[model samples]
Target: ETLMEWQEQRQKPHVAIFPGFGSGHHIPLLQLAKQLTVYHGFSVIFFTAKWMGASPHQTPPSSSGGMIRFIELPDVQIEGDHAGMSFLVRIPLLLEKANILVEDALTSFP
Candidate 1:
């Protein structure tokens, strides 16, 4: 392995990061993404709820100096007819949807 190989590897370390449902959850994740991209030369894809403002702050590698990106989540709704376990039970379902979104984003990465 040569220095060029190592540098190329550095340029290609991709990561996808998502935070849970609040600003408290968001800041820490964003800080870590910042460190990973700024200090370690990582390509980061950061996920935020659509309500959390993903598109405005997306910093994809092609778009800026910082290789951190933000992908927005779609609004999730539970079917009213199937509301047995209450909204709490629907949380995981929403996360499942988010996981699918993440998987799709990953597959689309080049």
Candidate 2:
């Protein structure tokens, strides 16, 4: 491939997606990301918080057609008793910390 082709690939619009905290949030967003990369010729970065555990239906990066990238942010532990907490109540706390990590990751992304 020529340098121009490589440069053009790099120039594809980059999309960053944060699907909050679970499968309900992640599944639809993953579909959107796949469509954006496959049909729209854009590159997508899908971010997940590590504390949420494995996604219910995520493909490994190697099989993503080189268009979608998955970033699993370092987990941030929320203090106090989370055993009784509802997911909705805990999301805000997780996101508050995840946002900073996201920012850092984006800054270093190509």
Candidate 3:
């Protein structure tokens, strides 16, 4: 390819986005991801839960010409008494369990 194209590709800033559990959380972040790639010329890595809890909007739009990528963190199992707990109270535990996978994904990201 051309030098300009190579330089532009190399210069694009990379952004890693991990939205919260439900659709309410995912939609806004997904919008931001789209804007970053489409308008700001950024490369984005969007992370989502493999098994979305109660959100109907599971499938987000596809990547923007390879500038944005979607990666699913493997299903996180919530054990113990969390079933009776509210979302706010249980989210920390959920995220803690998912942290390792997130780190791995970021480390191996190209």
TM-score of each prediction: 0.70, 0.76, 0.74
For residue 26, what is the lDDT in candidate 3?
A: 80
Using lDDT as the measure, the top candidate is 2
Candidate 3 per-residue lDDT over residues 1-110, each given as its tens digit: 47986677768998988887777878888888888888888988888775554332365556566676778788788888776899787778778888888899999975
Q: TM-score: which candidate is best?
A: 2
Alpha-carbon runs more than 4 Å astray in model 2: 1-6, 53-58, 61-64, 79-89
Candidate 1 residue lDDT tens string, 60-99: 3443345776777677665566457765776787788778
User: Global lDDT of each model?
Assistant: 0.70, 0.79, 0.76
Better of 1 and 2 by lDDT: 2
Candidate 1 vs. true structure, TM-score: 0.70
Candidate closer to the true structure by TM-score (higher is better), 1 or 3:
3
Residues 32-61 of candidate 2: C-alpha lDDT, one tens digit per residue: 887888778888888876576656235644
* Clashing pairs in model 2, backbone N/Cα/C closer than 3 A: none
Candidate 3 yields a Cα-based lDDT of 0.76
Q: Which stretches of candidate 3 lie over 4 Å from their true place?
A: 1-10, 54-63, 78-88
Model 2 compared with the native: what TM-score? 0.76
Q: Residue 90 in candidate 3 has what lDDT?
A: 74
Residue 11 lDDT (model 1): 72
